[model samples]
Target: MIDFITGRGLLLLSLRRMYELWVNHSSQIIKQFSILIGLPLEMSNNSDSSLEVFSPAKFPKAMNELSALLEAIAATSIYFKAEIVVSYIKSHSLRIEWIEANPALAKIVTSGLLKTFSLETLFEANRNNKNFLRDVENHISKQLLAG
Candidate 1:
Protein backbone atom coordinates (compact mmCIF):
# COMPACT_ATOMS: atom_id res chain seq x y z
CA MET A 1 0.00 0.00 0.00
CA ILE A 2 2.89 2.33 0.79
CA ASP A 3 4.34 1.72 -2.65
CA PHE A 4 0.95 2.21 -4.28
CA ILE A 5 0.31 5.44 -2.33
CA THR A 6 3.76 6.91 -2.97
CA GLY A 7 3.14 6.11 -6.63
CA ARG A 8 0.60 8.93 -6.58
CA GLY A 9 2.35 12.24 -7.19
CA LEU A 10 0.41 14.42 -4.73
CA LEU A 11 0.64 11.97 -1.84
CA LEU A 12 4.35 11.51 -2.50
CA LEU A 13 4.90 15.24 -2.44
CA SER A 14 3.01 15.54 0.85
CA LEU A 15 5.17 12.85 2.42
CA ARG A 16 8.40 14.58 1.46
CA ARG A 17 7.10 17.93 2.64
CA MET A 18 6.17 16.45 6.03
CA TYR A 19 9.69 15.10 6.52
CA GLU A 20 11.05 18.51 5.61
CA LEU A 21 8.78 20.35 8.04
CA TRP A 22 9.44 18.44 11.29
CA VAL A 23 11.34 21.34 12.76
CA ASN A 24 9.64 24.69 13.23
CA HIS A 25 10.27 27.08 10.40
CA SER A 26 12.14 30.34 10.92
CA SER A 27 10.00 33.51 11.04
CA GLN A 28 11.05 34.67 7.56
CA ILE A 29 10.44 31.22 6.12
CA ILE A 30 7.05 31.04 7.82
CA LYS A 31 6.02 34.44 6.47
CA GLN A 32 7.13 33.56 2.96
CA PHE A 33 5.48 30.13 2.88
CA SER A 34 2.54 30.61 5.23
CA ILE A 35 1.44 33.94 3.82
CA LEU A 36 2.43 33.51 0.20
CA ILE A 37 1.86 29.79 -0.32
CA GLY A 38 -0.85 29.12 2.30
CA LEU A 39 0.93 26.34 4.16
CA PRO A 40 1.56 27.15 7.80
CA LEU A 41 3.26 24.10 9.33
CA GLU A 42 4.98 24.58 12.64
CA MET A 43 6.47 22.20 15.24
CA SER A 44 7.98 23.59 18.41
CA ASN A 45 10.65 21.84 20.48
CA ASN A 46 11.69 23.16 23.87
CA SER A 47 14.78 21.92 25.65
CA ASP A 48 13.74 23.34 29.01
CA SER A 49 10.52 21.36 28.98
CA SER A 50 9.70 18.08 27.26
CA LEU A 51 6.83 19.38 25.20
CA GLU A 52 6.30 19.41 21.44
CA VAL A 53 3.38 20.85 19.56
CA PHE A 54 2.43 20.45 15.93
CA SER A 55 0.43 23.04 14.09
CA PRO A 56 -0.23 22.56 10.40
CA ALA A 57 -2.95 24.37 8.57
CA LYS A 58 -4.14 25.23 5.09
CA PHE A 59 -6.46 27.81 3.56
CA PRO A 60 -10.10 27.59 4.63
CA LYS A 61 -11.18 26.67 1.11
CA ALA A 62 -8.94 23.61 1.06
CA MET A 63 -10.03 20.49 2.96
CA ASN A 64 -7.35 17.80 2.89
CA GLU A 65 -4.27 19.79 3.85
CA LEU A 66 -4.58 19.52 7.62
CA SER A 67 -5.90 15.98 7.41
CA ALA A 68 -2.95 14.89 5.31
CA LEU A 69 -0.48 16.54 7.70
CA LEU A 70 -2.12 14.90 10.70
CA GLU A 71 -2.18 11.56 8.91
CA ALA A 72 1.52 11.94 8.21
CA ILE A 73 2.20 12.57 11.89
CA ALA A 74 0.09 9.56 12.86
CA ALA A 75 1.94 7.42 10.33
CA THR A 76 5.34 8.51 11.58
CA SER A 77 4.31 8.17 15.20
CA ILE A 78 3.17 4.61 14.56
CA TYR A 79 6.28 3.92 12.55
CA PHE A 80 8.57 5.25 15.27
CA LYS A 81 6.62 4.36 18.40
CA ALA A 82 4.81 1.17 17.51
CA GLU A 83 4.55 -0.12 21.06
CA ILE A 84 2.84 2.91 22.54
CA VAL A 85 0.47 3.46 19.63
CA VAL A 86 -0.40 -0.22 19.41
CA SER A 87 -1.23 -0.34 23.10
CA TYR A 88 -3.42 2.71 22.79
CA ILE A 89 -5.15 1.16 19.78
CA LYS A 90 -5.83 -2.02 21.74
CA SER A 91 -7.50 -0.14 24.57
CA HIS A 92 -9.43 1.93 22.06
CA SER A 93 -10.63 -0.40 19.31
CA LEU A 94 -12.24 2.41 17.35
CA ARG A 95 -8.81 3.93 16.85
CA ILE A 96 -7.95 1.19 14.35
CA GLU A 97 -11.10 2.00 12.38
CA TRP A 98 -9.99 5.63 12.30
CA ILE A 99 -6.53 4.66 11.09
CA GLU A 100 -7.94 2.33 8.46
CA ALA A 101 -10.36 5.00 7.26
CA ASN A 102 -7.57 7.28 6.09
CA PRO A 103 -5.97 6.34 2.78
CA ALA A 104 -2.80 8.28 3.59
CA LEU A 105 -2.53 6.36 6.88
CA ALA A 106 -2.97 2.95 5.21
CA LYS A 107 -0.20 3.94 2.83
CA ILE A 108 2.18 5.69 5.21
CA VAL A 109 1.93 3.07 7.96
CA THR A 110 3.60 0.39 5.93
CA SER A 111 6.42 -2.05 6.66
CA GLY A 112 5.91 -3.32 10.21
CA LEU A 113 3.82 -0.30 11.11
CA LEU A 114 0.79 -2.05 9.63
CA LYS A 115 0.84 -4.45 12.57
CA THR A 116 0.57 -1.56 14.95
CA PHE A 117 -2.94 -0.78 13.76
CA SER A 118 -4.20 -4.27 12.95
CA LEU A 119 -7.20 -5.47 14.94
CA GLU A 120 -5.45 -8.79 15.54
CA THR A 121 -2.84 -7.10 17.74
CA LEU A 122 -2.74 -8.89 21.09
CA PHE A 123 -2.87 -6.70 24.15
CA GLU A 124 -2.39 -7.43 27.82
CA ALA A 125 -5.67 -8.49 29.39
CA ASN A 126 -5.70 -6.50 32.56
CA ARG A 127 -7.63 -3.66 34.24
CA ASN A 128 -7.10 -1.58 31.12
CA ASN A 129 -9.51 -3.90 29.29
CA LYS A 130 -12.35 -2.25 31.17
CA ASN A 131 -12.96 0.17 28.37
CA PHE A 132 -11.80 -2.06 25.53
CA LEU A 133 -14.83 -2.62 23.36
CA ARG A 134 -15.21 -6.27 22.46
CA ASP A 135 -16.13 -5.99 18.81
CA VAL A 136 -14.57 -9.27 17.81
CA GLU A 137 -16.85 -12.28 18.12
CA ASN A 138 -15.33 -14.51 20.76
CA HIS A 139 -18.06 -17.18 20.58
CA ILE A 140 -17.47 -20.53 18.91
CA SER A 141 -20.38 -22.50 17.47
CA LYS A 142 -21.15 -26.12 18.43
CA GLN A 143 -20.65 -27.29 14.82
CA LEU A 144 -17.18 -25.82 14.67
CA LEU A 145 -16.29 -27.29 18.03
CA ALA A 146 -17.46 -30.73 16.89
CA GLY A 147 -15.49 -30.45 13.65
Candidate 2:
Protein backbone atom coordinates (compact mmCIF):
# COMPACT_ATOMS: atom_id res chain seq x y z
CA MET A 1 0.00 0.00 0.00
CA ILE A 2 2.83 2.39 0.79
CA ASP A 3 4.53 1.49 -2.47
CA PHE A 4 1.29 2.11 -4.35
CA ILE A 5 0.80 5.50 -2.76
CA THR A 6 4.44 6.42 -3.33
CA GLY A 7 4.22 5.49 -7.00
CA ARG A 8 1.09 7.61 -7.46
CA GLY A 9 2.66 10.55 -5.65
CA LEU A 10 5.71 10.29 -7.89
CA LEU A 11 3.46 10.20 -10.97
CA LEU A 12 1.69 13.34 -9.82
CA LEU A 13 5.03 15.03 -9.20
CA SER A 14 6.22 14.07 -12.68
CA LEU A 15 3.05 15.46 -14.21
CA ARG A 16 3.51 18.73 -12.30
CA ARG A 17 7.12 19.02 -13.47
CA MET A 18 6.09 18.45 -17.08
CA TYR A 19 3.28 20.99 -16.78
CA GLU A 20 5.66 23.58 -15.30
CA LEU A 21 8.09 23.10 -18.16
CA TRP A 22 5.32 23.46 -20.73
CA VAL A 23 4.00 26.63 -19.08
CA ASN A 24 7.47 28.18 -18.81
CA HIS A 25 8.38 27.40 -22.38
CA SER A 26 5.05 28.55 -23.79
CA SER A 27 5.08 31.75 -21.72
CA GLN A 28 8.62 32.59 -22.87
CA ILE A 29 7.71 32.04 -26.50
CA ILE A 30 4.53 34.10 -26.20
CA LYS A 31 6.41 36.89 -24.43
CA GLN A 32 9.11 37.00 -27.11
CA PHE A 33 6.58 37.07 -29.92
CA SER A 34 4.45 39.71 -28.24
CA ILE A 35 7.51 41.88 -27.74
CA LEU A 36 8.59 41.51 -31.34
CA ILE A 37 5.16 41.90 -32.93
CA GLY A 38 2.78 43.65 -30.55
CA LEU A 39 5.04 46.23 -28.93
CA PRO A 40 6.48 47.83 -32.08
CA LEU A 41 3.09 48.07 -33.74
CA GLU A 42 1.45 49.55 -30.66
CA MET A 43 4.26 52.08 -30.31
CA SER A 44 4.02 53.19 -33.95
CA ASN A 45 0.27 53.68 -34.06
CA ASN A 46 -2.28 54.01 -31.35
CA SER A 47 -4.87 53.40 -34.06
CA ASP A 48 -7.74 50.92 -34.06
CA SER A 49 -6.14 49.07 -36.97
CA SER A 50 -2.96 48.42 -34.97
CA LEU A 51 -4.94 47.07 -32.06
CA GLU A 52 -7.26 45.11 -34.32
CA VAL A 53 -4.36 43.24 -35.88
CA PHE A 54 -3.28 41.92 -32.53
CA SER A 55 -6.78 41.54 -31.14
CA PRO A 56 -8.41 38.18 -30.46
CA ALA A 57 -11.29 39.22 -32.73
CA LYS A 58 -8.96 39.62 -35.70
CA PHE A 59 -7.31 36.19 -35.47
CA PRO A 60 -9.78 33.85 -33.86
CA LYS A 61 -8.72 30.94 -36.04
CA ALA A 62 -5.05 31.43 -35.32
CA MET A 63 -5.73 31.74 -31.62
CA ASN A 64 -7.78 28.56 -31.69
CA GLU A 65 -5.01 26.75 -33.55
CA LEU A 66 -2.44 27.87 -31.02
CA SER A 67 -4.74 26.86 -28.20
CA ALA A 68 -5.24 23.44 -29.75
CA LEU A 69 -1.49 22.98 -30.13
CA LEU A 70 -0.90 23.84 -26.51
CA GLU A 71 -3.72 21.55 -25.46
CA ALA A 72 -2.25 18.72 -27.50
CA ILE A 73 1.12 19.19 -25.83
CA ALA A 74 -0.44 19.22 -22.36
CA ALA A 75 -2.67 16.27 -23.10
CA THR A 76 0.29 14.30 -24.37
CA SER A 77 2.15 14.83 -21.14
CA ILE A 78 -0.89 13.82 -19.08
CA TYR A 79 -1.40 10.71 -21.14
CA PHE A 80 2.23 9.80 -20.70
CA LYS A 81 1.90 10.23 -16.95
CA ALA A 82 -1.25 8.12 -16.88
CA GLU A 83 0.53 5.43 -18.85
CA ILE A 84 3.39 5.43 -16.37
CA VAL A 85 0.97 5.11 -13.46
CA VAL A 86 -0.88 2.27 -15.12
CA SER A 87 2.37 0.49 -15.87
CA TYR A 88 3.49 0.82 -12.27
CA ILE A 89 0.21 -0.56 -10.99
CA LYS A 90 0.41 -3.49 -13.36
CA SER A 91 4.01 -4.28 -12.51
CA HIS A 92 3.42 -4.15 -8.78
CA SER A 93 0.03 -5.93 -8.95
CA LEU A 94 -1.39 -3.10 -6.96
CA ARG A 95 -5.06 -3.36 -6.06
CA ILE A 96 -7.81 -0.72 -6.14
CA GLU A 97 -7.47 -0.29 -2.40
CA TRP A 98 -5.03 2.61 -2.76
CA ILE A 99 -7.39 4.49 -5.06
CA GLU A 100 -10.25 3.84 -2.66
CA ALA A 101 -8.16 5.22 0.18
CA ASN A 102 -7.08 8.32 -1.76
CA PRO A 103 -10.19 9.94 -3.13
CA ALA A 104 -8.32 12.98 -4.48
CA LEU A 105 -5.97 10.88 -6.56
CA ALA A 106 -8.85 8.72 -7.67
CA LYS A 107 -10.82 11.72 -8.88
CA ILE A 108 -7.82 13.12 -10.73
CA VAL A 109 -7.02 9.83 -12.42
CA THR A 110 -10.59 9.10 -13.37
CA SER A 111 -11.57 12.51 -14.67
CA GLY A 112 -8.12 13.08 -16.13
CA LEU A 113 -5.58 15.75 -15.19
CA LEU A 114 -5.68 17.27 -18.67
CA LYS A 115 -9.37 18.05 -18.41
CA THR A 116 -8.93 19.55 -14.98
CA PHE A 117 -6.02 21.74 -16.06
CA SER A 118 -7.33 22.54 -19.51
CA LEU A 119 -6.39 25.88 -21.07
CA GLU A 120 -9.47 25.73 -23.26
CA THR A 121 -11.60 25.63 -20.13
CA LEU A 122 -9.81 28.74 -18.85
CA PHE A 123 -10.29 30.59 -22.14
CA GLU A 124 -13.92 29.58 -22.31
CA ALA A 125 -14.50 30.72 -18.77
CA ASN A 126 -12.85 34.03 -19.49
CA ARG A 127 -14.85 34.56 -22.65
CA ASN A 128 -18.27 33.21 -21.77
CA ASN A 129 -18.22 33.73 -18.06
CA LYS A 130 -17.11 37.21 -17.20
CA ASN A 131 -15.36 37.65 -13.85
CA PHE A 132 -14.02 34.12 -14.01
CA LEU A 133 -10.56 35.29 -13.03
CA ARG A 134 -11.98 37.45 -10.30
CA ASP A 135 -13.91 34.47 -8.96
CA VAL A 136 -10.80 32.32 -9.09
CA GLU A 137 -8.78 35.01 -7.33
CA ASN A 138 -11.40 35.34 -4.62
CA HIS A 139 -11.49 31.59 -4.14
CA ILE A 140 -7.73 31.43 -3.84
CA SER A 141 -7.72 34.37 -1.47
CA LYS A 142 -10.24 32.66 0.76
CA GLN A 143 -8.27 29.43 0.72
CA LEU A 144 -5.05 31.26 1.58
CA LEU A 145 -6.75 33.16 4.37
CA ALA A 146 -8.17 29.95 5.77
CA GLY A 147 -4.78 28.30 5.57
Candidate 3:
Protein backbone atom coordinates (compact mmCIF):
# COMPACT_ATOMS: atom_id res chain seq x y z
CA MET A 1 0.00 0.00 0.00
CA ILE A 2 2.84 2.42 0.80
CA ASP A 3 4.50 1.70 -2.53
CA PHE A 4 1.24 2.26 -4.35
CA ILE A 5 0.75 5.64 -2.65
CA THR A 6 4.30 6.68 -3.49
CA GLY A 7 3.82 5.76 -7.15
CA ARG A 8 0.55 7.67 -7.29
CA GLY A 9 2.17 10.77 -5.81
CA LEU A 10 4.96 10.61 -8.37
CA LEU A 11 2.45 10.26 -11.17
CA LEU A 12 0.61 13.35 -9.97
CA LEU A 13 3.83 15.33 -9.74
CA SER A 14 4.76 14.35 -13.27
CA LEU A 15 1.38 15.41 -14.59
CA ARG A 16 1.69 18.79 -12.91
CA ARG A 17 5.16 19.33 -14.34
CA MET A 18 3.90 18.47 -17.79
CA TYR A 19 1.04 20.93 -17.46
CA GLU A 20 3.40 23.68 -16.38
CA LEU A 21 5.74 23.01 -19.27
CA TRP A 22 2.91 23.07 -21.77
CA VAL A 23 1.59 26.34 -20.39
CA ASN A 24 5.00 27.96 -20.57
CA HIS A 25 5.62 26.68 -24.09
CA SER A 26 2.23 27.86 -25.26
CA SER A 27 2.71 31.33 -23.76
CA GLN A 28 6.09 31.68 -25.45
CA ILE A 29 4.63 30.66 -28.77
CA ILE A 30 1.89 33.23 -28.37
CA LYS A 31 4.31 35.98 -27.47
CA GLN A 32 6.55 35.20 -30.42
CA PHE A 33 3.64 35.10 -32.86
CA SER A 34 2.22 38.32 -31.52
CA ILE A 35 5.55 40.03 -32.03
CA LEU A 36 5.88 38.62 -35.54
CA ILE A 37 2.41 39.95 -36.35
CA GLY A 38 3.13 43.36 -34.84
CA LEU A 39 0.57 42.98 -32.08
CA PRO A 40 1.66 43.94 -28.60
CA LEU A 41 0.68 41.15 -26.26
CA GLU A 42 1.14 41.45 -22.53
CA MET A 43 0.49 38.54 -20.22
CA SER A 44 0.28 38.94 -16.47
CA ASN A 45 0.41 36.23 -13.84
CA ASN A 46 -1.43 38.03 -11.08
CA SER A 47 -4.09 36.38 -8.93
CA ASP A 48 -6.22 36.41 -12.04
CA SER A 49 -4.28 35.47 -15.13
CA SER A 50 -4.89 38.07 -17.78
CA LEU A 51 -3.82 38.69 -21.36
CA GLU A 52 -3.86 42.16 -22.80
CA VAL A 53 -3.57 42.59 -26.54
CA PHE A 54 -2.83 46.10 -27.62
CA SER A 55 -4.27 47.14 -30.96
CA PRO A 56 -2.79 50.34 -32.26
CA ALA A 57 -5.14 50.48 -35.25
CA LYS A 58 -8.29 48.75 -33.98
CA PHE A 59 -8.61 47.01 -37.33
CA PRO A 60 -11.29 44.36 -37.74
CA LYS A 61 -8.86 41.70 -38.91
CA ALA A 62 -6.62 42.44 -35.97
CA MET A 63 -9.51 42.06 -33.59
CA ASN A 64 -10.44 38.80 -35.26
CA GLU A 65 -6.94 37.48 -34.82
CA LEU A 66 -6.99 38.51 -31.19
CA SER A 67 -10.25 36.69 -30.65
CA ALA A 68 -8.87 33.56 -32.28
CA LEU A 69 -5.81 33.67 -30.10
CA LEU A 70 -7.97 34.16 -27.03
CA GLU A 71 -10.11 31.19 -27.95
CA ALA A 72 -7.05 29.03 -28.36
CA ILE A 73 -5.88 30.01 -24.93
CA ALA A 74 -9.28 29.38 -23.45
CA ALA A 75 -9.31 25.90 -24.97
CA THR A 76 -5.95 25.13 -23.53
CA SER A 77 -6.97 26.42 -20.11
CA ILE A 78 -9.53 23.65 -19.77
CA TYR A 79 -6.98 20.93 -19.17
CA PHE A 80 -4.84 23.23 -17.06
CA LYS A 81 -7.91 24.60 -15.20
CA ALA A 82 -6.97 28.23 -15.37
CA GLU A 83 -9.22 31.23 -15.88
CA ILE A 84 -7.79 33.83 -18.21
CA VAL A 85 -9.20 37.30 -18.46
CA VAL A 86 -8.66 38.96 -21.81
CA SER A 87 -8.54 42.67 -22.41
CA TYR A 88 -8.12 44.70 -25.58
CA ILE A 89 -6.52 48.09 -25.32
CA LYS A 90 -6.96 50.43 -28.24
CA SER A 91 -4.33 52.92 -29.29
CA HIS A 92 -6.07 55.82 -27.62
CA SER A 93 -5.51 55.54 -23.92
CA LEU A 94 -8.10 58.23 -23.19
CA ARG A 95 -10.75 56.20 -24.97
CA ILE A 96 -10.12 53.21 -22.74
CA GLU A 97 -10.30 55.42 -19.70
CA TRP A 98 -13.56 56.87 -20.91
CA ILE A 99 -15.02 53.42 -21.37
CA GLU A 100 -13.94 52.41 -17.91
CA ALA A 101 -15.46 55.50 -16.43
CA ASN A 102 -18.84 54.60 -17.80
CA PRO A 103 -19.83 51.53 -15.82
CA ALA A 104 -22.99 50.85 -17.82
CA LEU A 105 -21.26 50.98 -21.15
CA ALA A 106 -18.37 48.93 -19.79
CA LYS A 107 -20.66 46.18 -18.61
CA ILE A 108 -22.61 46.14 -21.85
CA VAL A 109 -19.50 46.04 -23.99
CA THR A 110 -17.80 43.41 -21.85
CA SER A 111 -20.83 41.17 -21.76
CA GLY A 112 -21.33 41.48 -25.50
CA LEU A 113 -17.75 40.65 -26.22
CA LEU A 114 -17.62 37.66 -23.85
CA LYS A 115 -20.89 36.34 -25.21
CA THR A 116 -18.90 35.10 -28.21
CA PHE A 117 -17.26 32.40 -26.18
CA SER A 118 -19.14 29.67 -24.38
CA LEU A 119 -16.63 29.43 -21.60
CA GLU A 120 -18.89 27.07 -19.69
CA THR A 121 -18.28 24.48 -22.37
CA LEU A 122 -15.23 22.72 -21.07
CA PHE A 123 -12.45 21.36 -23.29
CA GLU A 124 -13.85 23.07 -26.40
CA ALA A 125 -12.62 26.44 -27.56
CA ASN A 126 -14.67 28.23 -30.16
CA ARG A 127 -11.90 29.64 -32.28
CA ASN A 128 -14.29 30.16 -35.19
CA ASN A 129 -16.63 32.40 -33.23
CA LYS A 130 -16.58 35.21 -35.76
CA ASN A 131 -19.92 36.57 -34.62
CA PHE A 132 -18.42 37.54 -31.27
CA LEU A 133 -15.61 39.34 -33.03
CA ARG A 134 -18.09 41.14 -35.22
CA ASP A 135 -20.13 42.19 -32.22
CA VAL A 136 -17.07 43.55 -30.45
CA GLU A 137 -15.83 45.35 -33.55
CA ASN A 138 -19.19 46.88 -34.16
CA HIS A 139 -19.45 48.10 -30.59
CA ILE A 140 -15.97 49.61 -30.61
CA SER A 141 -16.51 51.22 -34.00
CA LYS A 142 -19.73 52.77 -32.84
CA GLN A 143 -18.17 54.12 -29.66
CA LEU A 144 -15.07 55.50 -31.36
CA LEU A 145 -16.95 56.82 -34.35
CA ALA A 146 -19.52 58.53 -32.16
CA GLY A 147 -16.82 60.24 -30.18
Candidate topping lDDT: 3
Instruction: Write down the RMSD of candidate 1 (Cα, Å).
Output: 18.9
Off by over 4 Å in 2: 1-6, 30-50, 54-147
Model 2, span 1-147: residue lDDT tens? 112345777878777877887787986775665453322213225433322222343334433543443343343323233323332222322246654554443444444432323223333324433344344334323422332
Please report how far candidate 2 places residue 14 from its true position, in Å: 0.4
Residue-level lDDT tens digits of model 1 in 25-113: 55667566545444334424454212432121223212233233334444242322332333333453224554555434434434244
Candidate 1 Cα lDDT to native: 0.35
Q: What Cα-based lDDT does every candidate model obtain?
A: 0.35, 0.39, 0.40
**Highest TM-score among the candidates is held by which one?**
3
For candidate 3, write residues 1-147 as lDDT tens digits.
112345777878777777887887988987776565444454334333223222325334444544544553332222111111223232112244545445444443345444333222210211244444345445544434333
**Candidate 1: residue 147 lDDT (0-100):** 23
Measured with C-alpha atoms, the lDDT of residue 111 in candidate 2 is: 48
For model 2 the local lDDT of residue 45 reads: 55
